[model samples]
Target: MAWYGQIEQLQTIFDELERLLPSGAQLTSFIATTVHFMDCLINNQRGNLFTNVYHNSTVRPFLLPYIPSYARLSHRKWFRYAFIHAFHYYCSFEDFEDERIYIEAIFLANGYSLDFVKYHWRQFLKRFNFSLIELTDLN
Candidate 1:
């Protein structure tokens, strides 16, 4: 098929897909250097692609509350899991630190003490053999 015919075919497909969606919602597409999908921000700089975690502004931050009614072990496990998630998703140290602060705030608002968060954060760094300086320098 000719290149122009292929373009028309692609447009027709996109129109059909948009019609399948509910009313008032449109299927928009892009051909760009950057794209945000699900929870990831992806970028193509030249030929190298980079990805980092993406948070939508409309969404609120939430985590399991560290209240007395819940088991302490469960609270601790979830607390540590937040750190693990931050480490896994953030490609840059600056982004990770921002996420770290956000994580602490969410827990604090949900009743976890600052001391509790600080101690676990320190332990997490230690277990990963990461000093504050090293973490910053490496990323």
Candidate 2:
């Protein structure tokens, strides 16, 4: 499926999950199911590689500009964590090696160092694996 299609599929699942949230289901269960749903949407039986790329580089640029500067500044730890998660999600979904390199350049031009990007990249991978395992029971 195309990217927008995948996103729409996730949105539909989110809408369903939101409806389920008030049912007193365990928060961990809800989040795990939600993440698993997103994983399935992106992976679509193809496997992990595409999902990784889509989650990381392709999605970062759009998301970065929208994050409130105050939030990014004052909540640096949380922001970094969230950013890495989103980036990892994008990277997980798409193959974009050249785009990854390009995004690194853009990040540098925008005042982030390659080291910073790499740090998040590694962090995301770790979290991604853990989350995937937690969500799908497929570690």
Candidate 3:
């Protein structure tokens, strides 16, 4: 989908989340952070902004490459699903890590379900870790 369409879809999801979640400082903070994350992800300059930071040896190999054709076809849905999972993982784990507060705050504000988030988190960890292990063995 086009960037505008993606933004619209995210806005709709946020609206639904707002309706479902209770009002409070926690909710407000989560919503703000979620919106900011979405904006950053969708922004054209995001590659230049965070790609290097995020592509460290610890994380880079697990990330899907930014190949437009593959992204447009084979991996678009996977990318979306992985991102949702990543966001949730970042949120729940960060509660313990403290240093991850910025990313965690965004996920909480977005109002993704804890159950769904947890499920995704496990899947992401399993898949990425498996891939990392396989790559290491090959090397």
Candidate 4:
């Protein structure tokens, strides 16, 4: 395909991702979509990758300018943590809170419900295996 075709396809993928906000969002889909969006942002030219695709490269700069600045430019590590942890390939909590904050910010930025934290809080915890369920015995 041509360069313009690739750009158009990327834009379409990005737009469809926007369609999956708080209502129709699934954790797996969201992660995949974000990865695709990141690919477009970092692809300066087709297959020209001396740059850091992970966005965690101190050796190479992150290229996703479209990712909100408030999301913190140094978000790659926490994202990597979440990605790896989800697969149970690795598990650690060095800066897990920051990762949650980053994902939350992205959800809100994309017009997800403002009460996302409240509504999905349990699901989020369960997904990450950090349940916070609390109940009192009232027998």
Model 3, stretches more than 4 Å misplaced? 1-101, 130-139
Can you write out model 4's per-residue Cα lDDT over 1-139, one digit (the tens) per residue? 1134455676677677667757666433232222333422222344342222233435333223345555552544444444344323112232334444555565566455657434565544555665433211101
Compare candidates 2 and 4 on lDDT and give the better one: 2
CA lDDT of each prediction against the hidden true structure: 0.76, 0.48, 0.41, 0.42
Please provide, for model 2 over 1-139, each residue's C-alpha lDDT reduced to its tens digit, 9 standing for 90 to 100: 2233455677676678768888776433232211334423344443322343334334555334545546544433543555454444553323333444555565566666667777765665575564434433322
- What's the lDDT for residue 2 in model 4? 18
Model 1 steric clash total: 0
For lDDT, the strongest prediction is: 1
lDDT of 4 at 45: 44
Mind giving the per-residue lDDT tens digits that candidate 1 earns over 41-120?
77877766766667677766665543778876577677677788778777788988988888888788878789988998
Model 2 — which ten-residue stretch has the worst lDDT? 27-36
Q: What is the alpha-carbon lDDT of model 1 when measured against the actual structure?
A: 0.76
RMSD vs true structure, all candidates: 7.0, 10.9, 18.2, 16.3
> How high is each candidate's TM-score?
0.60, 0.32, 0.25, 0.30
Report how far residue 7 has shifted in candidate 2, in Å.
26
Off by over 4 Å in 1: 1-38, 45-48, 56-59, 63-70
